[model samples]
Target: MATKSLASCIFCKIIKGEIPSFKLIETETSYSFLDIGPVAKGHALVIPKYHAAKLHDLPDEYFADTLSVAKKIAIAQGLENYNILQNNGRIAHQEVDHVHFHVIPKPAASDEEGLVVGWPAKKPEMSELKALHEELLEKLG
Candidate 1:
């Protein structure tokens, strides 16, 4: 079945050639292009041709293809270290509704321009952790 495109989505427009982009890679089911607002020098965005607002909404094949293209781009850029970031919803800082993956190349661990993640580790009750794990497992099934 052919997936419907989102007329108002910028990524959809780019895929349709309605908008111009500095394309990096074009695959059978995905498209990669340079990010206009890049955090690093070789920052790129890979997105599926199908219009999916959330990552889970994408077909399995589309999701796989998107990641494959992202990996290819990373290799081509000679990126030994990089970050693959996917934001699902607004709360996760996903400004764009279309599902896309960010491939950001990092030169060093101290590179301020690259992804800086902070982990505030807390000791949670075993019951809480087990409950969350069970919920996720149920959803996965």
Candidate 2:
């Protein structure tokens, strides 16, 4: 069954035209719009029309459509470099309950306003890696 909008969701309000947004594109299952709190000039957000709190909670077709719209936004913006970010839960920095992907177009490397990430690399034992990989593969089955 198709999901319905959550009445209290800000994104749902945007989708329903109850709230105004700088809309870029809209498909049967997804909607793309310019972010009011953008990280860069062409920063945009692609969201499924259906209200899904997490990525895994969304229907497969809706999730796929959301990603497809994000790609289209990047190409339309003429972005050579960009970041697609989706936070799943509150612990992962998800402020909004709706499932949305951020399509942030990167500027020059020196520009700090774009997508910035800190990767703290750590090398783990081969056995640890193998165990985790096996666990994930089993879950995927």
Output the number of the lDDT-best candidate.
1
TM-score of each: 0.91, 0.94
Model 1 lDDT per residue over 1-141, tens place: 376689999999998889999998887788899999998998999999989999888888897788889999999999999999999898888999999999998888895887887778999999999999999999999
Q: Model 2: per-residue lDDT, tens digit, 41-115?
A: 989999898898998888777877788889889888888989999999888889999999999988789667788
Q: For model 1, which pairs clash?
A: none
Model 1, total clashes: 0
| Regions more than 4 Å wrong, model 1 | none
Question: Candidate 2 at 89: error in angstroms?
Answer: 1.2
Candidate 2 worst ten-residue window by lDDT: 59-68
